[model samples]
Target: MADGLNDQRTVRVADLLSDFRTLQYYIAAAPTEPSHSDDYYCEGWAALRQCSIDGQHILNCAAETRVPRVRGGPDEQAKTELQQVMLDSFSRRHEAQKIYLRQAAAQRWVEWRDSILCGGRPHSGNASQLASCDAQLRIDLAAITDDSIYSDMRSSDYQMGRWTLEDPRLRDVQRWVRARQ
Candidate 1:
């Protein structure tokens, strides 16, 4: 009974370490959204901090070790670069939305007049209303697309075939399987 209990504890510890490692990897790889700088990073950091607190031993080792400046080998650099590009593109789109919203707000009267003259129906009562509506629309659309893309990227069956260790429990299982094999 004591042996079984010890084995269970060891397994739990290993799982915690694996989870810690996966969270660290995510912090290093996930991109920021331009709509709110540091939002995603803050969330990721908080998660990592929690993992560190829970997995003290693994966290200590990670803190002492220096992660390489580059992730993956040269062979995978292209894929990494591509992912970065996609992230940048999304960030730019979010920025563009903000700029457009601001401009639309500032020129609400002109926009309304132009749209009305161009045979489009007016959506709001005043400049502020129009701006708020526009901003909401942009935010909603961006969020939908962003969520879809992020979901696809995080999917277990994503086609790009990059190594993602998002789930700590899975990492533990993988390590144990490899060790046993």
Candidate 2:
């Protein structure tokens, strides 16, 4: 039981890292031209960095908890405490991501609105539509975070850490934005 618990904790920490990597990829691939402001990119970058830092902390916490000296017995309290920490970290990261996403979505909307309102395009997937799409994506992402699927995945047995800026999931988001253009 102890071995299983340790393994689960390790894997959960790894999954958090994976999520962070995906976020990094998404932020890096974000459209700077559409945003038209360094401040926007800076905010996104900061959020990604925060996610990475949180993931590292969660990994360290998992390692510490797995060590015999830190948690010697098969105490449910220890496991529960660790789980709460993981969840709290995830929640904080998700909240930060939400703020970034919202800002990005708003920027995209403004770009589209300007294009349409200025007669640049005749209602052929302009900023308003892009804004709507971004809003929907934010809603979907919020729902997923509320479901806490990532947190549950961490409790599994898979050491899936070391995220990079090339996750397919983030690519899909980029594609969605381009599809509007």
Candidate 3:
């Protein structure tokens, strides 16, 4: 424990740092194998990163003061809510996808609205990745549009069709907006 930090606070901070390191390792390995394509690994990485940051914030704020207690920790309502969210996240199918789609939609919608409304120009980054995915997208669409008997439909359609900006800065902006919300 650091100087005046209690055992609980010390343990929490250590646990958080350990979790953060684990995430960093996974992120490093994400491009290696089958894990690269797993949504669980990708989403888990994001969640762990956010959690690590939150933990760091907690430690920083409590550095000079005492740690705050979590009131009524893990009540029945909280447990039920956790289970419900877990179920919803998987069953809803588009919960995470919607965030990406909504972001893409809102950006394009805004630019189009702005251009027509105020004679402004659209951002160059808009739909940048769309070009790279063009061939695959066309094939996917063709497969879907064909007759059911002749169609090669196998599983759920993963065609999260949409536009996306390639600018790295847009991610920061998106994360910032999400944090504020």
Model 2: per-residue Cα lDDT at residue 140: 41
The per-prediction CA RMSD against the true structure, in angstroms, equals 17.5, 12.1, 19.0
**Tens-digit lDDT track of model 3 for 1-181:** 1223233333433433443344344333322221223323332234334434433332233111223334545443343343333222221222122222222333343334334434433245533433333333334334332123112111222232211111113233334324333
**Model 1 / residue 41 / CA error / Å:** 37
Poorly placed runs, candidate 3 (over 4 Å) = 1-5, 32-181
Give a tens-digit lDDT track for model 2, residues 1-181: 3434644554554565566556555554554442334334333334334444544443333321332334446555565555544443444344335434544554454454454456453355564564564465456435544235434333332344432222223334333323332
Q: lDDT (0-100) at residue 120 of candidate 3?
A: 31
**lDDT values of the candidates?**
0.36, 0.44, 0.31
lDDT of 1 by residue, 59-122 (tens): 2322212223455555345434433333332232222233233333324433443454354433
The per-residue C-alpha lDDT of model 2 at residue 35 equals 30
Q: How many residue pairs clash in each candidate?
A: 0, 2, 0
Model 1: ten consecutive residues of lowest lDDT: 58-67
RMSD (CA, Å), candidate 1 to true, equals: 17.5
For candidate 1, report its TM-score. Answer: 0.24
Error of 3 at 53 (Å): 16
What is the TM-score of each predicted model, taking all chains together?
0.24, 0.37, 0.20
lDDT at 144, model 1: 35
Candidate ranking under TM-score, highest first, comes to 2, 1, 3
